[model samples]
Target: MRPDPEGLLPATEPVTLIDSDGAPVTPARAAVPPASELVAALGAMITARRFNDQAYALVRQGRLAVYPSSHGQEACQVAAARVLSDGDWLFPTYRDTAAVVARGVDPGQTLTLLSGEWHHGWDVATHRVAPLTTPLATQLPHAVGVAHAARLRGEDTVVLALCGDGGTSEGDFHEALNFAAVLRAPVVFLVQNNTFAISVPLSRQTAAPSLAHKGAGYGIPGQRVDGNDVAALLAVLGAAVDAARTGGGPQLVEAHTYRMQAHTNADDATRYRDDDEVAVWSRRDPVERLRTFLTRRGDVDEARLAAFADDAERLAARLRDELAADLRHDPSELFEHVYATPTPQLREQLAMLRDEATRDTPAGGSR
Candidate 1:
């Protein structure tokens, strides 16, 4: 028999687990995974956290141009990825590298996307993971379109479009939500409510009390989850996925998490918020909280934790080496995908670009 759907949430309340100090707390409904799954989730979160920190260091040291740290948002990412099947599609934003990793995207390919080699890292046709979009909320429409196509073809797969809270303010967000509602498309609008968009606070983004409630305007189910709690994230995502696959249409989920680090390597959050605020959110670090929980429960040992740290360091080192050697892209490649068949206008533009390139080259210069 299928698990009782109502059991995922006993009431219309948010789910959570550990507090800032890593103490156990009663959530609306907390269902812990088995030991192996727990360890895997914990390890993945560790890997992502370590990778982001290393990337930040690299940026500061001038080895990288930009880095978006996923410090306190791992559960919001990994849990969503864990709930999806291999056939499902992921439309990720720049901040969802952890979700892409957990969704089975190769680290090398993901790094390649960020490394500037290619926009569409892998043949998403093969991996079922679309290229990460840097533009704020553009992926939402593509996700809804994919879901509509799947429904028309009678496929059981769903699409999860992960975006930030700030993305909801974009017109694409509203259009995608409205279209999905009209078509009853099987998609999950997973919004990671990190409480800030760059320097903009959530208070400035919307006057609505809850981001989840934004879905009601579009005629879909919506709920908010405590994004720091891995179990809660998983349970809520699983429920949302189940509802989607069962032809219940779309669901909007607002994951309440914090961006414990700056928005990007180029951002200085200190200008808007103080060190005390950072220190406060630092206490709610997702990785440390999970590690403490597992340790206290005797689910994972100190030796295992040490091994995880070693693995994360090794992965980060390997990624740096790989990315260092892969940082070139052809400007013409961007024009190649604008149309299935190049129109006269595109043809003229390409020809003009080639002529300029040829004219700029000195006689007998290296190609």
Candidate 2:
């Protein structure tokens, strides 16, 4: 007896559009959004790259406590934000500052958590973007809850939750995926398989065929896409978001990309990885690939490209100026949101801090 040709088979490769040389290997499909829309997406990726560079600079200058640069993964960041509607929500990890900015959160405000500020920089309620989470996989549950609530309230809202390869190992990641699948929540879980969870490489992360396969256990459709290809990312992520919005239930997208920088300013990627590996990924740079494709199609000219560069530079300068400004925050703010009603121990600590501040000030002079 022979097996049926229609039998289920494993995915052989990730969805790809343009190759590293900027040549289209696949025919353009109608599912591809308009040229203008793709151009805008490219612009967002360029701007995000500039922002990531500026953040790295800020960390080096002691302005920011630390920064997880999303240099090589800007395509994932841009596509994740572009696919969401204004009424939707985005739950980002620490390295997803670019996605939050792409969602229209102010650059300075978005950097507040990295700047060692008291609270999350922007207004979550107004922007519909969650605070950049430092704890691994914690935002997954939050995203699922919001999506489930939206379904209950009969609201037309979708939630995009982002995480890295390491985050998938967290228990919260499994819990969120299972709950979302069981409840048929309107959420898209994007796992950027950047090849490392800090010093640990993906080889040791999991033995599964691919990270996308993990979603299958929870009964959610999973897809693998070339994270370095902007066109492919936009196409895959857009479809996932649309499906969730129209009651298709939750979906998982595992984008295969690389982290070109250290985990954060505090880490030393050089110790764990080789220059040869970094050099290999450098050739597949997302920004250059998109720019080349657009230019080849005559959709973008030198003058227009220069204007985009100018815009990115202006954004970086604005962020630098805002972050460089002298702004004093009250120390008392640390205790403000700790609890609706302050605990006795917290009150005592606040009093001690206030007393210390008073003693440090010159007599009869304002601090």
Steric clashes per prediction = 0, 0
Q: Write the per-residue lDDT of candidate 2 for residues 1-367, one digit (tens) a residue.
A: 3323222122568887877888786665425556797789888999999999999999888889999999999999999999999999999999999999999999999999788877888999999999888899999999999999999999979999999999999999999999998988999999999999999999899998888888878878888888998888889899989999999889899999999999998998889999999999999999999899889998888998888889899999999988996558777888878999889999999999999999999999997
Q: List the residue pairs that clash in candidate 1.
A: none
Pairs that clash in candidate 2: none
The whole-model lDDT of each prediction reads 0.81, 0.90
Model 2 TM-score on a 0 to 1 scale? 0.95
Regions of candidate 1 where Cα sits further than 4 Å from its true position:
1-13, 61-63, 326-338, 341-367
Weakest 10 consecutive residues of candidate 1 by summed lDDT: 1-10
